[model samples]
Each structure stands twice: as structure tokens, then as C-alpha cells.
Target: MDGLNDYRRARVAEILADFTTLQFYIAAAPVDPPNQEDYYTEGWRALRQCAVDGQHILNTGADTHVPITKGGLEEQSKAELQQVHLDALGRRHQGQKIYLRQAAAQRWIELRNGILQGKKPAAEHQASLQACDEQLWLELAQITDEGIYADLQAADIQMGRWTGEDPSLRAVQRWIRSRR
Candidate 1:
């Protein structure tokens, strides 16, 4: 019984550590733009490469390959992303950018500090960070894609949701950065 209890505790601690690291990678301003060394970003890189090369190993162990496209996937991806962003912004309420909840902003500051100091975030911090992420997605959802597009000027094209110097608010409106 003692051994099993110890194992459970250890497993919980390990999970918390991993979660903290992920939250740091996502919310930490220090690693803004997400370096390749950050967790899970490599998957996107691999997918993008596969899209361009027209190949994917369905089973890595078996080395089974599948082709997606012969070429120009990159360009197509850009265009689609641009269109998505334009569509989203076209529905914004007076071009409103990312808004952070006060509680989340407080947690964001604390989490960034913990990440910098290499400390695991407290459970409450994790919840707050998660809430912040959820709020952002919810706000994005409100930006209807079917909104008027003709009203958009070239200057209205915002780009990139890079993490920032500001803790209270993020510049998520400038998402996609297609630079049409």
C-alpha cells in the first residue's frame, strides 16, 4: 500500500511538472513565438514539411508513407490563413484586439515569473492560465467569418498573436501575419 501511494504521488508530481512546462511554453513571454525546442511545435514543422514534400509516414515505426500534395502547399496554406484572419477581423467589434481578464492577467504575471525561475506553477495558476486561453478562443469565436470583407482596408490586416511585453493584454488581433 505504501509503495502504491508513493507511486501515485510521484506520478501526480510528474504530471504537474509537465503541465507547468507546457503552460510556460504557451504563456511565458520569454519563449514568445515558440522556438523549435518548445514542446509539440516540432509536430507542426513536420506537418508543414510533409505538406510541401507531399509525403507523410503514417506509421513511423513501419515507415509507411502517404502523399498529400506535390507542391505549393505552403502558398495555399498562407492564402487560407490570410483569408481566415481577414474573415475573423471583418467581424471584430470596432477592431477590438485580444482582451485579458483581470484575474488571468494576474496569473499570467505570476506564471511567467515561475517559468523564468524554473519553478512548477501552482494548481490554481494552471487553472487561471487555462481560463485565459479559453477566453481568447471564445473571443475569437465571436469574430464571425461571414462578416463584411469589403470594409477591410489593407492597413486593417493585422498579423500575428505573438506573446508580449504586456501582461494585461495580448496583441492577438494581428493574427496570421499574411502581409497580403
Candidate 2:
């Protein structure tokens, strides 16, 4: 069980790193030896991919401004691993098919909630987050100005903000800055 859990965790990480929303959806389950189908054909695939991305960002190696019990690599019990798997799968099965664009919009909500609740850290993470925010903002802005809508579209979809449709230059800029 431990080995399987580790493998699955690694798989999830790779999926998150490899996809951006524009790529085809790689089905994680409910199918035999599931495989990825390009979004050009599978609409649902895009949504599932978006949810995966959202979960990854929110659960990055730390709390999303809220203290959730640590799990996965840091966890020791099978129950913890199971909970992580179930949580990820449940989100995929529940909720409307999330799109990358919608996911990005949701990031703002996460940030606001985290801040409103007074989720603060010792000055260390603050500087790191600020730098990350600035870098991502600049990159997104540059991409937007270059008229790289496809990239933004992929990012939006991966982030699960599908309802927002195509990402606007302003939205991408706002989302990037609002992070951390």
C-alpha cells in the first residue's frame, strides 16, 4: 500500500507539472488503464485536469493560509494516504467540471479567505511568496501582451476557471498578483 501510494503521488505530481489546460485530458480513472485524450475531443478531460491543477496549487507543500493536517509524504498512516487519494478523487467526481480559467478566478477567492481569516506566517514565507508572485505576474503579462491567448487559455483551464472562458490580459495579471 505504501509503494502504491507513493507511485500514485508521484503520478499526480507529474500530471500537474506536465499539463497547463491546453493539453489533452489524461483520464485518471473510471476507465480501464485510463489514458489521456486530447481536449480537442474529450471535453470532460479538460475539467478533470483543471481540478487536479487546482488541488495541487492549493495544497502545495503547506497550508493554504489555513492549517490542514499534513499528509502524503509527511504522513505515516495508510489512513492519511487514503484520505488524500479520496479527497482528490472526490473533488474530481463532485462539483461541476472545473476549467482552468475558472480555477484561476478561484485562486483569488482562496487568497481572500486565507487573508480574511488572518492566516499569517513568520516573515520567511512572505518574501518568498512575494517574489514568486512578482515573477509569475511578469511572465503572464508578457505572454498576454504577446497575444499568446492559447497559453493563457490553457492556464485558465488548468486552474479550473473554465467559466471565465478565454483568459483576458487583465484577468491573468490580476490572478498572478493575487497569489501567495
Candidate 3:
């Protein structure tokens, strides 16, 4: 049973080595603007490979076929490099260039930090909702049943309502009513 576990561990180490090689290749590849998404996707894949590779490297002994090299220095370096790659991928995967939620969260954090540090400007220390101008506030602000009916009438282009007038709002409303 121990031998079986050892054998499995050795296989895992071998697989990890392959994965690390793949990651190195991905990291070394050049990126094109239009294919940036593809490049990032590949980067993520590479990071995943590195994680698997590092795990197997740890699982198997340094004396195994997977060479740790001169007190495991090379393997250690590779593992560290892979970890950096993984972190980079994780940060990148968190959002796209114009993600709304990420931008909002970042903005909120920045605002909070600035306020906490007393760096925020006196005029803009906190986010505020702009009040409606009193001059612009009219009876339209509080819509009436008549207004809703008028809007429904205007929306109906066809004379489908009870009114027979071709261009009247009621006619349009009637037309719409028939369709529904």
C-alpha cells in the first residue's frame, strides 16, 4: 500500500513538472491587442498548471525523478515563480477592464481611505445625492391618472382604442388594446 502511494506520488510529480513547463511557456508567450482576452485566459491556465505542478512537487520527495536540484533550490525558485504567476492571474481574473462592480468597489474604497486619512476635500468628503431643482418641479412630477391615460394614448400609434379618430391618442390606445 505504501509502495502504491509512492508510485502515485511519483506520477503526480512527473505531471507537475509537465505543468510547470507549460506555465513557463505561457508566461513567455507574446500578447496581441485584439487577442488580449485569449492571452489572459492562457495566463490563467498557466497559473492553474503551476499550482498543480507545485502541489505535486511538494507531494513527491526531492530524491524522486523530479529533480529538486542542489538542495531543492531550483524547484523552490520555480515554485515561487509559479506562485507569483498564480497571484497575477487571480488579480486579472477578478474583473475585466471596465467591470462596473469592481470600479464601484474600488471607488468606494478609495473614498473611504481618503476620508479616513483626512485627505478628502472639504467639498467632496462624502458622496451626496443632488436634490431636484424647485423651478423644474411641476405638476408633472406627481403624475395623475389622466396623465397616465394620455401617455397610454400617445403610445398607441394605431387607432385600436374605443375612439375612432385615426391620429387621436385614444385611437392609438384602442389599436394597442386590440393587439394585446
Candidate 4:
């Protein structure tokens, strides 16, 4: 934390505090019976390791010089937490994979339509999309759940559904618009 600018030093201090809190929670977590090839458990392990890595960065809570790093403890912690979320989402939607697939297709169409109409960024993207065959483009609607999930992952977009009693499409449309 030494030899750094005031802003960087403050940011590092905040990150370190977050790591300490995360470490405490990780240590206090109940022991879950291990499941074979469990992605959720693996994510927790990665997160726990990230907390431990932070301690190393801080020299076991001793004051230490930290150099600027893109792949530091903070970055790894965020990545691990995101993985945990994705894993949970996949598990929860296992039964409604078809629904998720359809939703993903709809999102795809929405994105492409925005780009093609110049409602979204990149005119070059619009030109490329315009050249796409209309019939072929609609084929995205028939993709498998795995295919849809792959697209979401590659795009770094989180996909999920609302189960609220209100069946209004407005909430969903607003969400899509925000993303665009």
C-alpha cells in the first residue's frame, strides 16, 4: 500500500477491507457436503482462495508495498463471485431451459434490430447485420438452451427471467432498452 498515490492507496485500502470481510464469511461458511463436479462449490473455493491471495498481497495483514496490477485480488474476487452467480442461474433454470433459450433468442433479435436500424452504436455493425439473410437470422429463435447460454457468456450479458405475478412486458422491455 506504500509508495502509491493518495487515490490509489485509498482504493487499495478499501479493496483490502472487502477482502478481509469476505475472508471472515468464507471462514464462517457452513460445510456443504461435496457434490461431484459442483460448479457452485468450485466457485466458492475460487473466491476463498482470492481472499487468501489478498492476505498474501498484504503480507499476512502486515503493511506491504503493492504494485499496480490488473489481475490482483480484487479482480479475481469479482470474477469468482460472477462465476458463482452464473452457476446458480444455470442450476435454477435447468427445468425451464427451453424458456431461457427463447428469451435469449428474443434478446438477440432485439440487439440486432437496434444495430441494423442505427439505434445502437457502430454503423459498420449495422451494415454487417443488414447483409444477413432475414430467414437465416430468425433461425436464432430455434437454438438450444446451451447455445443461448454460450452466446450470453460470450457477450458478457447476464440472462434471467422474472417470476413476479405481474405479467407486464413493460418491465422486460425497459430492461432490454437499458442494455441497448
Query: Which candidate should be chosen as best, given lDDT against the real structure?
Result: 2
* lDDT to native, each model: 0.32, 0.38, 0.33, 0.37
Best by TM-score: 1
State the lDDT of candidate 3 residue by residue for 1-180, as single tens digits.
112333333433433443455444434433332333323332233334434433443343322123344535545544443333332222221111112222232343344444436342245533331111121122223433335445434443243322222233344333333323
16-73: candidate 1 lDDT, tens digit per residue: 3433443333332222223343333322332233232221111112212233433466
Question: What would you estimate as the lDDT of candidate 3?
Answer: 0.33
Task: Report the Cα lDDT for residue 133, model 4.
Answer: 31
Q: Is candidate 1 or candidate 4 better by TM-score?
A: 1
Per residue, candidate 4 scores C-alpha lDDT tens digits across 12-84 of 3433443454445434433331343322332233333434433333342221223445766665444443333
Q: Give TM-scores for every candidate, taking all chains together and pairing residue i with residue i.
A: 0.24, 0.22, 0.20, 0.21
Error of 1 at 4 (Å): 80
Candidate 2 — which residues are off by over 4 angstroms?
14-75, 93-96, 100-180
Which candidate model has the greater lDDT, 2 or 3?
2
A best-first ranking of the candidates according to their lDDT comes to 2, 4, 3, 1
**Model 4: colliding residue pairs:** none
Kindly list the per-residue Cα lDDT of model 2 for residues 83-115, writing each as its tens digit.
443333223222212333333323433443354
